[model samples]
Target: MSVDVTWLGHSTVTVDVRDTTGDTGGDPAGRLRIVTDPVLRAGLAHLRRRPRTPDPSASAGCDLALVSHLHHDHLDLPSLRRLRPAVLVTPPGASDWVRWRLRLPATRVLEVAVGGTAELELAGGAVRVSALPAHHAGHRTGSGLSRAPRDARAVEHLVRVPGAFPARAETDLLLWAVGDTGEFEASDAVLDAAGRAPDVALVPVGGWGHTLGPHHLDPRQAAELVARVRPVHSVPVHWGTLHPVALSRTMGDRFVDPGPRFVEHARRLGVPGAVHLPVGGRLTLDGTGQGTR
Candidate 1:
């Protein structure tokens, strides 16, 4: 058994869990694909995707899609339409927005609040996704002072695949995505949400603009989170993806420096498993908690 992760760009990632031990009738390999916070387009507002745009095939055939908040960058409707996942999990108050924007039926869209869990049954095994607390603002306009929806809030997600490791039947493969959060003391709560230490963690290292607010984590702070969670493997995200069109030349370093800077800080803190994955890079994690790029 192994899990393959591909960082498409920004916060979007595709996690494929393969169960080689099971008998997948029509679907050989018994693979389940899950995508997170997909922003597939080349441009959004004043921001433009640097280097290149994401390939549509990267998010193709996704079983489930997870939306962290109501922010436009995290929950792009056009990108969601491209994937057309069988199930879409979003924050508590954003169900209606998803339904209205994507015209998806109520049966396909699920709203999971903090501490709430949603289970999905696959051909190979079962998956449990739990919503955790996030410190970032959740308004669509990116401002708390604006007239935002009362129930809108940001959340992190914990994805657990039962029996993913063939060697250890009692241990499950846990992947925690700390979506758009700041430096906070939620280590205990995050550990409790996953029921144990995470096998893999996808952490945000930077934001889109020149300045990151107090709600966002910088490179050093991201490394601190990795030290606390202590996952078997950690991948840095939310950097080196988008930037303002005018500042693409002036702020080039800001768009491309966080990932490497995080690796540096993680090494100083004696944090193992801090891997920096470039855009469209793929990493494979085997049953023994080892990874190959």
Candidate 2:
């Protein structure tokens, strides 16, 4: 019935879903918590978290954790160890990478391919997580020189909470996480996979450096994707969080401008649902399908 979205910084987000209908007989276990692409550290390689570091307990008690790709920033092992979610989902061939780092049981790690779906049954209801295509390169890399085997892949995710209400329009809460990617012709397949527009879309608008490559979306391109998905609420992420330590003095603007620029572009495109959350800010969606800050 109600959903809370917390942006910890960069691609990391926490989605908490509550059953406002009181159908769980007052059981607290009725709620579901999901985390995505958690990077909960002070610094990573040449990048340092701007503004401040994320709280160490930010990933505590997550039910499901989703990794979009094998990239270091997205599939951070230290963060995953802190999270220790009940179930961990990753793009194809990533489960092995996760196992190599963490000692999680094979049953706890799942590899999902594009268009594949996984279901989590909770005390209150059920959640469906579907993997969607992403246009970014799949292999893990460091400094653009060293690379991992080209077996891993990147993917977007669609999380749907069903049985919210009796009405068809309000029966489900659809949250789409468009992981790191570039614009592509098949991007429209997201609509077909979701079957309808999502209630909230987590869109990435920038990267950790001064220049963005063709593999990632810039603010303007992110705004365009927001217009196409047309979710009831859109949260701009993957920016204003991390930047190269050496460029901190000279490229401060790059660290803080993408989220606001995405908001501005979305406004110009007549998509006012875009919400620019500061790192650690939260957005709540009430039972009536309205999003409030």
Candidate 3:
């Protein structure tokens, strides 16, 4: 089996799973495509795309999309509209916000809590996605305190209700996309939930501002995270991609340095499989669990 990951920019990535074993007798080209935290527009919110990165629209046509949180950049409505993934996964209590924001009447939204799993079967293979604990706040603008009573009540009830997930099923690929979070102490909880370290970890190493915010991981923290979880291969996301256009002239290297810095830090921390994927770059994992750029 092999999984291919394309880092579009920032937290957006396209993960394609293929059955390379030859035993499944599936279409060699048939793969389940999943995009995480997709932001498929040139400019989103206050930040503008960095020059020279691939077009953000390259993330379109995903089999599914996972929104880790409600942050503007992560759950971009315009971007989501472009992809129109068949299934959309969000954290608990977020369906109302997503629906209201996107007006996605036909799209199916799956509300998953920490440890919940959602499985999707596609043409050539199947994928199992687990919602692990992210050490971050879940608030989004125009949500919660700002929503009217009806919507607020719905969100509260959905959040309080327990998450329902399927029994852990066998899958061709298993990925843990740690959306946007700092290092956490509840790693055991994550392991217990997934039952194993992810085959590949798409971790956030930087953000739009000069200073990292609460619950966001900088390059060093991202390296430490890889050391702890020890995925077969880890790729840095949420860095060297989007930045405030006005600051680009003044802060030349700041927007494009974290990914390389993270590669060095992961090596220093003894994470044997840290891979730095530049914008539009791709990484592939093979049957023996080795990764190639």
Candidate 4:
């Protein structure tokens, strides 16, 4: 059993797994497809395509699409509306909005809370997903900066409420956890729930703005995160997709080096099994209980 991951640049990866042991239809090809934080646009705002285009969507029909958080980049409604996968998973309490955004039925949605797990049967294979905690915030707001102590709450990254998900669900079994945070305040709890290591950790490394703060990780910090979660392998995303066009004109080609820098840092830190795939790559996975280690 083996898992192939195609880097879709800027953190989106297609995790293709083939479990030879499972009976996933007569064709083995159908059991492969994991779409993570997909941003398929050739250009967004000022950021242009840095890598190749993804394997044609028809050819890469998705089995499972993972949305690790609620940030705009990861939980993009525009991108989500494009794929017609067998199942879609997201953080707990986010099914409503996701369903609304795509006008999808509750039957196809799975919300996973941190520490929760759900089994899914798709394309003749059974897969499991568990919600792990992220320390970052998922503030859809990207305008205006507030530094006043009273206005500090304006950061708008984390949103916690009593079961305040986008909408309600009826009987979706697989829990699609939207791990929408990456802050230290809840990191311990997240660490406890996901165990000593994560099967697949989709972390954020860049921000919509120029600086890193209470919301997301920079290149160096992302490298450290890799050391922390220690998943089997990783693919970078969330940068270079929506950088300010004016910002690039000022910095030249070096403007979009953060993702590449992260790859370097992972290598420098001896990130065993880590692979940096260019955008639009394809992967197949075999979740036969053999972890990335």
Candidate 5:
């Protein structure tokens, strides 16, 4: 199969990355739009979502929706509910949570633990979604998707716990992909057991604050990830968008320049073709070559 991809900022992507042959046309023999962790709302606890926009209708009918982990930004219930996916691919036990919140039927949300995948048939054809890695956490505030006006001071809610240690940072536990981690694929064991690298991976390389944690892969690090996974083609996401509230713009370049950085890395790694598309731009790519319109 061949595929086309569009980067919709952050971890959210419109992946028509199906197995159909190349350039199958806009509709393609297979143009299944995969909404990976869509943070559709304006503000998360502290970060302001980017200005990037996709055809709202484009997300209307989807073959499958993939929630890589439970991070609030990644597994946003409000965003997921709007998409109205006929099928949802998520981590191990999180389905119960999504189901509880969205009131979606048990069959609608196909729950797969980390290192597992689910196959679904779409209009164009079939696509496989594998639960990969993400360096963030998740939660649904009692008051669903906030309705209050913006706090003139910051973009998201800030919690302060001066010296208390954070959970998920302790190596002793294998909690969901929440909390801080090094800027490495700290979970190689999961990657290896899958037996094959992801053809298209949606990874997190940014955070909700001025500082970046180790577990997150910044754009440059993302490029390194590309060098390792070496998918035939890739889309650099989780960057150049979304900023924390009350925080000054000082944490700029790390989030702003990751896209181009990935491109540079791809070149240095001899990754022949790593295409980074515009916010809503459409692309048809393959190992055959690269072109932009």
Candidate 6:
């Protein structure tokens, strides 16, 4: 179980997981690539990506892409097109929006409900991703109101395709990617679905705005989440990346402040380990799976 996790920017993370044990199903070169909430484009409308952020192409080549909600930053169409994950997982209602409105025709978008599992059989072994319930609002179009495309059958041709992952090698990596969820109910659903704690928990500690609004977690609340779920290792995300184009000068530091604040809270709470990665920082866990800070 060797896992390499890199925070590309914002909620986007690239996890390269490999199994070192003999149980690699006879394939040793297998790698499971998982990415979450990819907002790869350098600019989003009026909101410009700050300095030192990875380019859109940095998110390319993932076996599976997970979307926690339908917000513009989290589910950007152009970003997804650039990343081109073999399999895309979203909340139950978002698949249609992504398929037609977002214009993703070829990608296999599987809308998974809370407690439902999207199982992937790789050359190494099986990878199970459970879509846990999220507390945030799922509907966010440029206009507040936008209906699904009239032709439901337009995307019927690309429903399920096998052979997404390459033939490779073994070990298990359970990742609970909780994106921008503020409520405990969402976490409880994740815990209920995950029989054991996740190897790494990618939690959102803050957003770009000066204020932390409803269905969002600030540094302290996010610390509470880490204390409750208690994963082997926790990485703070959704901060230090995108910012509103017209924020007040006084609150500008909010963008770069949350990650370290969350780490401090996690320490005070006595959590196992906290990897407060910079915008492009990375962390690795070897086969032994020790929580090294």
Clash counts for all predictions: 0, 0, 1, 42, 19, 3
User: Using Cα atoms with residue i matched to residue i, what is each candidate's TM-score against the true structure?
Assistant: 0.92, 0.91, 0.83, 0.69, 0.71, 0.82
lDDT for each residue of candidate 5 in 1-293, tens digit (9 for 90 to 100) = 33445666666765553444456455422445556666666666667765555557556556666665566666677788778876776665566656777888988887654445555565644444445444433333432453211211100110111111122232111111212223443444334534444334443445556666645666667667656756445566666667777554666665556667777878998874566655565566443323333
lDDT of the candidates, in the order given: 0.82, 0.82, 0.68, 0.52, 0.53, 0.68
CA lDDT for candidate 5: 0.53
Name the better of 4 and 6 by TM-score: 6
lDDT of 3 by residue, 1-293 (tens): 56678888888888766555456444322356678888877787688887564564465456678887777778788788878787787766777667776777634777665556656564433555566676777677655564612221111000110111111243324466787776668643545655566567787888887778787888898888778877767888988777775776765676678888888999998787788877889998665455788
In model 3, where is the ten-residue run with the lowest total lDDT? 154-163
Please report the candidate that would top TM-score against the real structure.
1
Question: In terms of TM-score, which candidate is stronger, 1 or 6?
Answer: 1
Task: Please name the candidate that would achieve the greatest lDDT relative to the true structure.
Answer: 1
Q: Over the full model, what C-alpha lDDT does candidate 1 score relative to the true structure?
A: 0.82
lDDT of 6 at 200: 80
Error in Å for residue 130 of model 1? 0.6
Off by over 4 Å in 1: 21-30, 142-150
- What 10-residue stretch in candidate 5 is worst by lDDT? 152-161
Q: Write the per-residue lDDT of candidate 6 for residues 126-189, one digit (tens) a residue.
A: 5666666667766665533556332211000001112221231223455767777676554555
Q: Write model 4 residue lDDT over 41-70, tens digit each, in one string.
A: 655534555445555652257777776655
